[model samples]
Target: MIATLVIGLREGLEATLIVGIIAAFLRRNRAPLTPMWTGVGVAVALSIAVGFGLQLVEQALPQAEQEGMETVIGAVAVAFVTGMVVWMRTHARTLSRDLQASASAALGRGTAWALAGMAFLAVLKEGFETAVFLLATFQASTDTGTAALGAVIGIAVAVLIGYGIYTGGVRLDLGRFFTVTGVFLVFVAGGLVLTALRHAHEAGWLVIGQQRTVDLGWLAPNGSVRGALVTGVLGIPADPRVVEVLGWVLYVVPVLAVALWPRAWRPSPERVPRVRAVLAAALAATAVVLAVAVPSGGGADLPRTVAVTGDARSVTASVDGDAAVLRVSGRGREDQITLPASVHRRVARAGTGADQWQVTEDVPATDRPTSLTLDQLVGLFGRVPVGVSPSTNPGPFAADWTVRDTVTLTTVRSGVLEATRSERNVLTLRGGGLPAARTTTLDRDVWTVPPADADRAATDLAAAQTRAAELRLWNAWLPLALLVAAAAQAALAARDRRRVRTPTTTTPGTDPSRGPPADVPARSLDHAVR
Candidate 1:
């Protein structure tokens, strides 16, 4: 709620400021305000409609697709907020002057309608950004009701403030106000960076750096007020991944520095060296820590056996480090299929839950034609099993399922099978009975398999981890670089302030050694200086 409120107040004030400036300018010229008001009204309606449309579109998508859409929205929101923050930081002081100038130009040209257009465009820009940002915040928040109420209150306050200022009933320090709010917005935007990356991973667009960086459960426990503030308002997940934390830091450090740095300050020669040294040292230290922390990755436990049972038969898959065995049994019949070491490694790399492999076999004439189709695989269970029947013609089957601790059938086709463990899984069948998709049970059971090569599996997993770590490590360099730059900027500002405070010994004369000219009296010289 606080996040949305700040967003609303800041954005609403900016819009109101613009509209008020234009309205006052028109009134001074004795022009009618009807066109300007009409434009503002239309823009407001469009913004509201756009927000609702985006929400509807999100609701219409499948879970994974919805995640993808959310990733896009979050990304766009981050961009919008960043741009708004930066632009406002630099432009807030000059906004009224610039708008008045433009309004005057329109009036001089007798194009009063251009003023209306300007009002429309300015309000629309702010409105569009507000809609997107609030949407992202609402999605991230645990309590939408409070978030909405806060936003409404914020906008109302902004409107009142804008009106008060326009009517000459209120005075404000616009520059100071914007500077304070700009810093807060930077924090909000940094949180958005984390949100976007999380959505990307869930959308399956990003898979690297999946390692847990730290356990933050204690910091953000479920169903607690502190948790809501930390996770919901601050946008930190209970357990953040390497990439998400990296993203947050990378965005926050430099952007916050920019927000806090004074606009008029310039770099001082004396401060640059110290700032550079600090920055360089930080970068080197970060590199050393990352190098030493690269995971060795050989100590993973054996993956749990996934036993999937349908109406007619039950299939159990046990995967050791290097090999996988699938056991199928029902109706007094048993069959076993073992994946080769290479196939097993590939499947393991795909992800946990073995849901994404398509295996094809080239059978010799004598080999039982191991190329099993969907129908043949189903036959391994039983005849005319309950809820499952052979279909003469199979239509395209594409559905997504979400269940806890449940085995999901991902795909079925000729000579190919793919399945995976995930919160959201897709099912695509070419020939299986529709009813067979009704119910499936996933049980955790132990199955003994032949001893396999542990070293090879460990090596594979380690290499993958190392690669992901390398990517994250490189990505981290950018933030460190920006941090150094911000530090230097800050050091320069401090130096300037100290210079201002330190008394100057030099006189106003170009030559401090030369007193007032011989012909000039001391009293006259002092008055001239003053």
Candidate 2:
């Protein structure tokens, strides 16, 4: 919720600021703001369309492909956002002036409508950016509602900022604002970079066989402060692939190089001392290095099986870590606590005893450091309901799942609970029967009722559900940040045009007004884009 709100609020404000600036500009110039509204509408509609399109793409994708898409978006977002941040910083004054001038020239078209159009288009540009950002984020966040709410708040704040700007009450040191936000963005981008890599790994796009990154579950989000921080920052899965780690490093390296290069450049005594440069570099290095130092193999989207005990005919128990789990609840008479297939057979086809009985206990083995498909992972809660498989919706259950150690229950006179233990088993439900045998790894929903502590099973399941919710929640909000960024870009552009057309005291191509900016010659905005 917080992530959604933050991204939404920030991005929303940006859009509102753009709208306000153009509206104010038109009002001052005695022009209709209709074109501005049209432009805004178009931009917003386009952004929405983009978001929906991306969502469709995400939904249509298989588990691995969905992950691959996520990875690509994160990488793209990091690149675009980081580049824009650096650009804004270097060209703040020049860009501002350019924006002012463009507004003036556009207004001169004598068509208040024309100037409004320019304003609208400017806002639209930002809108598209937001669209891309939101599309990426929507796929990553665990909740969309929170993200939507946050965006609304962001827009509201932006409106106020725009109003202040018009009334000459807003005096933001934009450079500083960008700097602080940029820093925050760096972490966010890093998270995305890490996340995308995880997706790519799942998709089989890149492979680094048999090496764990580092299991920092102690500090990792395996349920810790740092873990949450990392997750919130960029959908960063605690267990990352080599390629993912490499991607993160590559992306962040460039950002740091760009953001801190100037600060760290040793300057003469006459120049201002570079405290910020030193501090930024240290922070950047520390954050990355520490992340690297943390141990790998912390958490996985799927549960890591700890142990299981069952034989060919009937399997009785399972142990998830320290928790002792009971797999079969309907154990006939006698509390031997034994799952005897032979005895179950006695019950099976016996006179008037409901239906035949057959039991199988199949416990899966753990495989690591490899890419997994939807077939491999479950949303926690162990597997499906006892007897149910993951492939089918509420996949069929072999027998009554909730029975205690010994509870009387009816069975299908036909089927058998055939259990098989293997390192990687792929299960299939062929033609009719109970569970048509197929092969695969992983298990159906986990057996939640532990013979010892049923509550533990419930807790573990609940935690799994929570994690699933969180992953989706973060994904939903991630997009808002990008969208908000887009809006911010529009506002900055508008502001820049205003300054640009503001009739500077100097001539074109020559800065007599600011004394030619010392040794730097004035460059056109068009040139800057390249």
Candidate 3:
């Protein structure tokens, strides 16, 4: 909730400031505010719809797909927040000035809608980023309801603050406020990095460095207040894998350092090449590490085939992409049936063939019947082949025999199709010398792949995994790359500060005691409200 509240407060106030500026400009020009408000209302509604729609789509996906979607959303949220933070740090001082300049141009166009559209776009951009970031944070939170309420309250508070600033009823160091919030957001984004890395593994996007190296259970006991703050708010898991810690450290340390780095008043020409060289070297090292470190997994073993054979019949099946093809053989002929592949969460893709297919689903009655039935062949003075059939009733003898057939068709995680067929029969023997009933059963399972197509699919999947691993590795190393740049900035700041303290000769037209120029525009708040 605290994380979300800060996110909401910072984002909401930014939007509020924009709207306030636009409203004040219109009021000064004696232009009505209806069109601008209309645009803002539409943008807000669209942003809300986008957020809800994304959540709904995520919920409707399969487990693996859901994890994949979550990884994407979390990563995107982190990127948006990071970019916003960096951009705001540089632009906050000039924001009011820039908005006024744009507003003036819009009014000169002789249409209030132009300004309205500007307002709409400004709010919409912020709204979209807010929605995505909040969704990611909410998913990380243990109590989503509380998080959401906090966001609402934060936005409410931001509105009051924005109104106060506009009305000259509040006085604040806007520069200081943004700086503090910017630092806080950096930590939040760092946590999101950890969260995204964890999701990437669950989604099967990254496979290397999965060993659990840290145990934070003592620090974050479940259901404890500390746990809620540490795990939920901070986005740290009780037990994190090696990659997770690597990602968190690589992101947090360098990003925080850069965020807190002292600003330099002037650029140092001699140091530029040195800074570039350090960054280039870091990137090159990261590339070399990735090339050698990321593993190219050997192809996984194909699932073993299982078949049940009787005196005159047998059953087996193979995987064909998203579908399953079952083959049943009898006497001198073989028949095939195609069905959709069923996926079970508990089943292991690369396991002993014997242990596979522990759970099987019965073929539904809706399946189309085959041309020939085993019971018909049995009735022709042939040995009774009491084995599994695709259909419950497959021949005339089925009327005299009670047949129960259960079949399972599925595609395993390792890109293999597995099918199991089980059947039981009880036929009434009405002959003078025969017993009252005859009972027989057959069970079979098959795990196979077409030599060409299935192999290609597996290769493609492996290639995708490799690429994703490389991308994730590079992503984790990006912070170290940023550290190079930060180091240069710190060095420059130290040099400049030391020189200033040495009381060097002052330039003719410059005033050293004036310090840095103020960031806020004088007319920003004063002209925004009545």
Question: Whole-model Cα lDDT per candidate?
Answer: 0.65, 0.49, 0.67
Q: Which candidate, 1 or 3, would have the higher lDDT against the true structure? A: 3
Please, what are the lDDT tens digits per residue for candidate 2 over residues 1-530? 34444454445544554455456556655677777777778777877787788778878988887878877776676666676567655654454345556667787766766765676676666666566665556556656765666556765676676556545566555455556666666666677666666666678774432146876555555556576566654567656655456556756776866665664474443322243334444544554454455334222221222222332223344322222222342235212223334434334221122222333443332332123233333442344424434444332322111111222212222221222232323443332233444333343322222234223433444454444433432233223333444455455555555555576565667754332211111122112221
Candidate 3 structure, TM-score to reference = 0.60
RMSD per model, one decimal: 15.2, 20.2, 11.9
lDDT of 3 by residue, 421-500 (tens): 55544344332222233345333323233335444544665555555554554544444455565566556656655665
On lDDT, the candidate that comes out on top is: 3
Lowest-lDDT window of 10 residues in candidate 1? 407-416
Cα deviation at 398, candidate 1, in Å, is: 50
Global CA lDDT computed for model 1:
0.65
| Tens digits of per-residue lDDT for model 1, 100-193 | 6677787887877887888888999999999999999888887899999988988998899777777666666666677787788777877788
Lowest lDDT 10-residue stretch of candidate 3: 349-358
lDDT of 3 at 212: 82
Q: Each model's TM-score?
A: 0.59, 0.49, 0.60
